[model samples]
Target: MPSLYSAPVYWNEQQYLLSFYDPFTFRLTISLYIAGISLIPSACSAPGCISNYYPDDRVHIFRVPENPPELKQAWIRALHCDNIDRLKVVNVCIKHFREEDVEYIHKVPNGDGTFTSVPRYKLKLKGGAIPCLLPGCPSYYSSTSTSKRARLSYEPKEKEMLNQTIQLLSKI
Candidate 1:
């Protein structure tokens, strides 16, 4: 029985490492090596995330120049990424977005025994979308907490006015 291994192949003028393991015979074939293959860059766009694989539902792959500026800005604000620089070869993953924010989602399986789903081309993101809480992303939807903090940090003018009225009445 031949052992399973990875091989480097050139496809579409790009280099890819193909993994093959024939479970039936427990051997890899030579014809598989002759086939064309391509590899997608899996680095996620979320800040402080070092993920290099896209198998997770949170990991979304997209092409730049095809994405709108609004979607990019949301990621930039959430991830704190530099919008002016490092725009090339960057991808924003689904982990940074809420389900509603992602307008559309589609995936195609790469038929290489690896059950990884490749994202389709028509993925669209809703405008004014903000990233949800993910690693390194502070949750911005906690309005109640923010309101409490606001109350603790500053007294409302209305409260001060009410206090003054009470003091005047007490003196009278």
Candidate 2:
């Protein structure tokens, strides 16, 4: 019949009720409920919508990644290993695709248990084309097949890491 938050009730922050004068049979009822619960979780008293974590103070994602088993984990690893800690993850390119991302990264082992840390620059949405198209380079370089020329041009540090990997591959 009537809501429970129509009167001047202070259940949370930014929440106050407004009631009207009802003089039919001498009974008081609530008119409506309003508040800024959406901004603060602690102020939320709705059914199944309150928790210890505050929505406003949550970890804001600087970037979101595509579907992958280890999306943020991979990027976090990259950030922790080298001097490229300022670049935040704006997007995920997907499994094996991020290798071509413009970020200067090195997939080196952190030696902290069994994880690898890779660091690189922010991924650019365009201008990523494989470079191994030159005459001197063969169609496949030691099994990698192709290398992102853009990676070499834009992120030499990353390219050098790749080169090192290629060198190891060639020896085996």
RMSD of each: 15.4, 19.7
Q: What is the lDDT, from 0 to 100, of the residue 77 in candidate 2? A: 40
**Candidate 1 CA-lDDT value:** 0.51
| Model 1: colliding residue pairs | none
Question: Could you tell me how far off, in angstroms, the CA of residue 42 lies in candidate 1 after the best superposition?
Answer: 2.7
Residue-wise C-alpha lDDT for candidate 1, range 1-172, written one tens digit per residue: 3346655455644443455565664555343222343233456656666554432323455443335554454345545666535555666566655565565645545777545555646667654455454665455531212333234334455689899999999999
TM-score per model over all chains:
0.40, 0.16
Q: Which stretches of candidate 2 lie over 4 Å from their true place?
A: 1-62, 81-172
Pairing residues by index, what is the TM-score of model 2? 0.16
Q: Highest lDDT, which number?
A: 1
